[model samples]
Target chain A: MLKKRIIPCLDIKDNRTVKGINFENIVDAGDPIELAQRYVLEGADELVFLDITATQEKRKTLTELVRKIAAEINIPFTVGGGINSLEDAKAIIESGADKISVNSAAILNPELITEISKQYGNQCVVVAIDTKFVNGEWMVFRSGGKISTGLKAVDWAKKAADLGAGEILLTSMNNDGTRAGFACEITKQISEAVSIPVIASGGAGTREHFAEVFQETNATGALAASVFHFGQIPIPELKNYLKTQNIPIRI
Target chain B: MIAILKYNAGNVTSVENAVQNLGYSTIVTDDVKALRSADKVIFPGVGEASSAMKYLKEKGLDQVIRALTQPVLGICLGMQLMCDSSEEGETEGLGIFDAKVLKFPATALVPQMGWNNFTSLKGKLFDGINLENDCYFVHSYYAEICPDTVAVTDYILPFSAALQKNNFYATQFHPEKSAKIGLQILNNFLKL
Candidate 1:
């Protein structure tokens, strides 16, 4: 059976991992490669490197950092943030990343998803949709969850799937950094609407929160940043808790 | 010398780079002469089986590859093509290994992409490797475990990770994308 994955997301800026509070007041976490290796040893099922700094200088530095980290880690790693063109995706994939996540670039040109899927297989492309609730409806946000696209979360997810995105990484801005819990309603809706796997991101406080996400939503994986980073919830312990909850895990 | 069979598939450069990183000479070729004369033949592919096999047949490299007696390693789609048949294009395979590559049934999840571990490893390819060490994989179809099964990984079902028959060896995962342990496996195969 395909087990649910536990992913630790690292936001990289200028070759260093920067963790922010509600996407602001960024603080350096340490070297990207060392942090990634630590997550791998802590039983992280996979790693997500989101290069938050979208400048040209940061892009080159991030690419080189991805190469160094890819050379070290044995498990699959995903690189995202400022992936605008096929060349960008190809460069990162060639640098040893197993998959590429696209957000702003994907929304700006939806056809980019199709082109990438055609070139690198659908499995190599992941569409990351950051959603924020507005007027009692979840709307898609771009540029690190700041600019709202006004596109409904479920509709955008369906469109992304139709555009050939293999998986959907749905993050709820309302729940992000709150550590309250996952946006189960949004996650369940999107998961039910798409045939591909859905990874629920944002708002995870405890191990039971993970279990609730798995049980309440049809998500195939759950992603968290501070909870896993600040030692709030250890990955192995969370997996054990999920296992006891009868949720299938890799352990 | 390692000859990585090129068929317009992805990940060819990565494999070639890995070989070069290990201080081994590698040639990315579709030519029959270049492939047959090489010390080791590597069938590296990262695309649909039907289209790739089409290119292989078009160049008449399939016949040349099947005739080679030297050690041959197939990665991802290369491994699927070496089996008896594949459901990808409903196309016949090289029959190098007595196994069939079948598509994963459309369950909750279709493509088993990401890192998965190998167990029950056998043969020289897995030398100095530990069980449960995860390797990167990105595929929908899997080569079923058979008499040639050397290593196994689980997703929707337990499937062959590595398979060996005589001098022919294949892995469903992308060793090139799998980092160090992957490099170790590739190094082991190169040494073989």
Candidate 2:
């Protein structure tokens, strides 16, 4: 039985975790390694470190930080953001990352997904798509939701799976940081469209929100940021709640 | 010194790093001489059974590994290859253990990934680790529990988590990826 995963996502920039109210007003959280260790102890199923800074200074810092976190943490961790090429994905995985996630890179060069999957197994490749509803149609976003691509979210997801992406991490730009709930409609659409596991991200505030996402959507996991960071909901308690709800959990 | 038999399987670095963390030097080698002469052999792999067995035969490591008198520990695919046969690739194994590795039914999960508790452990590998302590796993094939099964874990059904027979011991889970309980298992194997 595959257990449903509870992941705490950390947005890294210049070696520090930066969080915003709604993808703006970024505030310093602390060192990524420290926060990672804290989350593990608090029963986080996995961690995702997204290097949001596209600058060279942040890239170097993220590479070194990934190695540091891999050395200290024992659970599976994923590294994403600004990963544009096969070499970037390889470097991160060799540095002890369990998986490498590509967002804009995949949309730009869809072949990169096949190339990376060929070099490293598909299990090591994750394709993340940032989506927002536009005129009753789900659209893909790039550059942290700054640019919108007219590709339908579900179509792109299916194409990613066909290109050998092991998993899909679908984040809703409209609901991100809103803490309202997941964009369950799009999540369900994409999840039903692909054979690979889908991890639902964005807009989770309370434990019930997680339950709603897992139950209402076809997501294999639920990833959040502010709620876990502010200690509003502990992972173990959330798992307990899900367990009572008859959702499969490791505990 | 520990010698981890390296072939085409993945996750070799994780094993090397875990051994190094325990203060033991490790060499990832496919050389039969290095593996045969090492203090202990760690056969680690993550791939299909048939292709991996073909690589071992091509390197003539299949013979060297079977003749090793020192304790040899196999992880994941390594454990499956130590058995008599595997349903994956419809291949034959080393036959060190009287078990057979079979793919999980498609009705069940295709790949059983993530952490699960081990029960009925009976070896040095589970030394300080409790029966219910969880260990990480990621595999589609499993070895049925036999007389050699030292520990068991359940997903769709009961399967061997750890197996031992004389000098050969194997685990179906990735101890190197299993956090504290994983490190403790590695420490116990190092002492052995």
Candidate 3:
């Protein structure tokens, strides 16, 4: 059986682990390498590093960080943010990251998804969609959920899959940092709408929130930042909880 | 030397790093001479089958790989290319394994991403690894079960999770990305 994945997302700013709530109020978490190794030790299924670095000059630093992490960490990890071109994707990939995720770049140029997918197989390309519930609908947001793209979340996910995205990282801005729960309604819609795997992100408070996302939607992965970083919900404990709930999980 | 065959495919860097972490020297190369002379050859790849095959043929790696006598381990797309054919692009494979690769039906997700366990394990490659231990897998097409199948995994359906025949060993899963269990599998291969 394919087990549901518990992903710990590390928002990297200036090469340090940070947590952004509702796409604002960034706070220091810990060292990425130490946190990554700890997650692997705790049996995290995978990891996601979103480089929130603002400058183009410091983009090279992420590649170095990716290299150090890839050299030390054993599990699969995806690196996103500040990747605007195929060359940028290539740098991260060559640095040894398993996958390179694209968000705003893909929305700005939907062809960027295809380009990365072509250069490095779709299996290595993750399309991250930041979405927010607006006017009774889930709309796509870009630039770290700071701007709306005006595209429907479900529609964008389907389009991304068709564009050759191997996976969809669906993060809900409304639920983000709230620790309320995942956006199961929109998650179900997007997961069902795409053929590729969907990783639900944002608003993961307790172990039950992870269970709810897995059970209520077809999401294969549930990603959280502060919950895992602050030790609010430990991964092993969460996996045990899921297993008891009859959800297939890797322990 | 453990030579990781590189023919414009992706993931060679990760594989190289994994092998080095296991205390084995590795070289990422397309050099026919280097691959043939290496103690073991690790053919790691992540890309479309047809395009990959085209690149291999262009680089003359197709023929060199077929003639290699050393233990050659293939991972993911590399495993698919070791088979007879793939439905991915109606691509012809290296014919090392008498099996065909086909895409998972829409009954489940197209790409079976995440960790999945293996069953009916056989051969030295799985020596230390526990039976049915989960390993990372991320692929849409799978090699159909055949005589070469040493291990099987059930996703949308039962398929070859790992295959072995003579000196050619292949895994549909990404051992390098599968955490400790994956590292054990790689170590097993290196020792073999």
Candidate 4:
């Protein structure tokens, strides 16, 4: 049986792991390698690194950081943000990320998803959609939620799946940064709409929230940043809680 | 020397990284001679079947791969291509395993992607690894359970998670990306 994945998302700024992390065991919180090693120790199924410094100049730095992380971590990791082209995805893959997550670029050019997956495999391409319930319907968001694509969130997920995207990383902008719970309604809708795996990202406050996403919907994975970075919910314990709930989570 | 066959598929970089972590030097190449002469060959992939098979046939490396007698390990798509045929694109495989690959039914998620455990482990490839330990898997297609199957993993249906026949070994899962237990499986293969 394929266990529901537990993923930890991190932010990288100028080649440093930063954002809401406060751990004394970390030699340098800015160091993604150190933090990645710790996540491995915590029994995380996978890791997501969103490069905050995704500028063209620092794109090289992100690749280098990926190489560093891949060296120390054996588990699958994804590198996202600023992935604007096939070449960009290639560089990151060459740097050793198991997969590449595309957001704004994928929205701007829906064909980009097919092209990247064509060049690389669909397994290498993860289309991340930031959706928010806007104007009575869940709409796709871009530019860090400032712009809306006016497309229904579930419809967009279906489109991405048709475009040969192996997986969908659906992030609810409204639920994001809130410790309430996942946007299960939209997640369940999208999961049913597509045959591909849907990874629910955003608003994972408690271990139950993770369980809720997996139970309420067909979400194959759940991701959170603050909850993990702050050590509010240790991954090992979270997996334990989900396991006891009869959720087949990776232990 | 360890050689990881590189072609149209992805995941070679990750495979190389894992091999190096195992303390063995490796080369990611499609070169004919290097592949033939390597002490051990790791055939790893992540791509469409027909296109990948086309790339292999075009490079003329397919024949070289077919001829290698050393212990050759195939990972994921690499394992799929080693079968007799695959339903994906109706592609014909290398026939090493005398098995055919089939897509998981849409009733369940197409790609049963995540950590799934193994049981009924056999062969040196899985030696010393707990049969209950979960390993990472990401694939829409699965190889059928055959006589060569050394391990079993049940998703919507039970299938060959790991297969071995003579010198050729393959896994439906990505052992390289499967964490510590995954590394142990790779180590077992290296020793074999």
DockQ winner among the candidates? 3
Better of 1 and 4 by TM-score: 4
TM-score (0 to 1) of chain B for each candidate: 0.97, 0.97, 0.98, 0.97
| Residue-level lDDT tens digits of model 4 in B42-148 | 99988788878888988887788889999999999999999999999999988899889999987788777789997678889887787678999988899999999
Specify the highest-TM-score model's number: 3
As a whole number from 0 to 100, the lDDT of residue A152 in candidate 4 is: 86
Q: Write the per-residue lDDT of candidate 1 for residues B1-112, one digit (tens) a residue.
A: 8999878667665677778788899898877788888999999887788888888888887888899999999999999999999999899989999999999987746788
Task: Report fnat in order of the candidates.
Answer: 0.33, 0.23, 0.94, 0.83
- lDDT at position B153, candidate 4: 94
**Can you list each candidate's DockQ?**
0.38, 0.41, 0.84, 0.76
Clashing pairs for model 4 are: A17-A30
Candidate 4 local distance difference test against the native: 0.87
Off by over 4 Å in 3: none
Compared with the true structure, what per-residue lDDT tens digits does model 1 show for residues A88-164? 99888877777899999999999999999999889888999999889999999999888988899999999999999
- Alpha carbon deviation, residue A22, candidate 1 (Å): 1.8
- Residue-level lDDT of model 3, residues B71-159, one tens digit each, is 99999999999999999889999999999999999898878888999767989999987766999998889999999999999998999
The 0-to-1 C-alpha lDDT of every candidate, in the order given, reads: 0.86, 0.86, 0.91, 0.87
* Residue A18, model 4, lDDT: 68
Clashing pairs in 2: none
How high is the TM-score of chain A in each model?
0.97, 0.97, 0.99, 0.95
Error of 3 at B120 (Å): 1.3
